[model samples]
Target: MALHLFSSIRGHRNQINALSRVVARGEPGHAYLFEGPEGIGKDTVAQALLARLACLDAAPQAADACGACRSCAALLRGEHPDLVRLARDGATIKIDQVRSALGRLRFDPVLGRVKGLLVESADLLREEAANALLKTLEEPPSRTVFVLVSSKPQLLLETIRSRCQVLRFSDLSPDDVAALLVAEGVAPDAARVAAALAEGSMHRARSLCDPARMALNDEVARFALALGTAPPTDAAAWIEQIAERRATLAQAQGADSDNAEADEEPAARTGKTALTREDLQWLLDVLRAVLRDVVLCGTGIDAASLPHARHAAALHAMANRCDIGRIVAVVDACQQLEQRMGINPNPRLALSALLVEAGLRLRAT
Candidate 1:
């Protein structure tokens, strides 16, 4: 089955409306930062904008891609020569790729008057590549448009950001996501939970439609609960957790018993909730989410209103123990550990430090 290209979906009508405003204005700038959570239609917005730019009609301020038009039809088939997108998957967009793509954008379009370069996962650009991108963003080709889409816009350099028009995409309401899911044949209850946990990012929410993501959610819950509530004081309890965590990781990694056991024995540490580096990073992400939810809850942000209420109870409980200020500090600590872990990549030591710090701040009352 074919997926709705962002605006065709019911939940994202408002977003499409906003993008229409940008295009209708015929803004002078050709560079834009399409910022939003994952799967919120940044790429779709970029496409629609690309179509609108090439569109001759001046009516309909909310004018989007004319799906029936030649340009739109070509784009729908992913055959438009005018649309050149650079997306990094599981790696950074190399400096060469960025440079070459920009060079290609300089040419006159094969059919359409305007050309677009949509760089998906823009934040994955390495430092050198990002610097290269900055030059083009500063002085973009007149007939070409550049759209940078990212879930982590902060990863980009400030100078590069200054050159582009920034458009923010927000998550749809749970009611909205649920309605879409139900329309697509998902059960009402399941859609609701996915919407809540997706936290406004429809991409994530849709991915959660799979039963596997639900299992991942459960694992995250269990790990967080054990870390927060269960004190792994002795090496024996730590070993038990190691066994459990390794078992989970093994399944995720699709490891044979021999290989899984090998990684577990040497790399895994004992005593006091020793989390593996991968697990440590994951735990840090989970903890940060928890802290974010704690802040949200304490601020009177109800679970019903937020996306991804899966951990709402945990967030609320933690909020009851700590204030928002403390929660912010905890989040900062988690982010710091995540960076340090990236450089050090020491799971046992990293896990110990993070948990110990968080454990100390467990009760900020």
Candidate 2:
């Protein structure tokens, strides 16, 4: 059987078909950008595209690969000489890597019908690296394709952005996520809960299924509940506990494992041994979800819509003790914290201030 492009992807069928049509028409662009949130199947699509472009036995009108072909087999094994996947150096994609890859692109395809370069987490490309990549995109080689995958395309240089054909991937709906989870062997009930909490991310939903991660989320939820009842003196302690927990997680993941959450997140291009910005943002996201649930409960939204439905009672109690105005403020604070975290702020101080403010606001009413 032929290996259809995006055959295993749960969503983005339209996007996949559009690309397939391009391939069938023999009009695949020399430079393309796959922009979307992490774990939303951008990588899968890229791989499939590579296989399609390199398939030896595929017909000119075919939209997929002949799985039995030697080229297709090589692609499946990730050893195709014509396919090159680039990753970050230490924390960013440095200029050196870009120059080197561009140098390789100067050569003709050693095997397969097309030469392909895939830059995962392309947003991590530094200024110099991006400039170098832009040059290549400007005068791209014939019979070659460059696929740049990034969750944050805005981080890429505008010049670089303008040169590529961009394909946007939307988040998967809850129903779609639930169906996928069920197909992956998760119980129906668990799949529904995980889908609700996934925030349209399969990677997040899968992590939510892990006992350890779920326990961590539960601990955060418990702390959010106790904030309404605990004295103000306990604020610092709660913040410290969260920090300690983050530290432990950071240790478990180690410095190089910053992308362990999604595997596609950029590594430290500088080779530093510490948590990347993404790790801090992830913790903030957890807190933000808790605050969002409190707001939902305060506003009388149905429990069915709550991502943390299992903690509905605690959330309701917290909701009763706080006004809608205060809940909004906390959510706003979380958003601000998330944005600020990108600028290299002191994590401990920033997180402490946000949590303390949330605590004070919840008790105000």
Worst ten in a row by lDDT for model 2: 267-276
Show model 2 residue runs off by greater than 4 Å. Answer: 1-4, 59-62, 176-194, 219-247, 254-256, 260-365
Q: Which tens-of-lDDT digit does each residue in 225-284 have in candidate 1?
A: 334344543423443465466546546645433321232234444334434555555456
TM-score result, candidate 1: 0.59
Q: Estimate TM-scores for all models.
A: 0.59, 0.65
Computed on alpha carbons, the lDDT of every model, listed in order, comes to 0.65, 0.75
Q: Superposing every Cα of model 1 onto the true structure, what RMSD results?
A: 8.5
| Total backbone collisions, model 1 | 5
Top-scoring candidate (lDDT): 2
Clash pairs, candidate 1, are 171-200, 196-307, 196-308, 197-308, 277-347
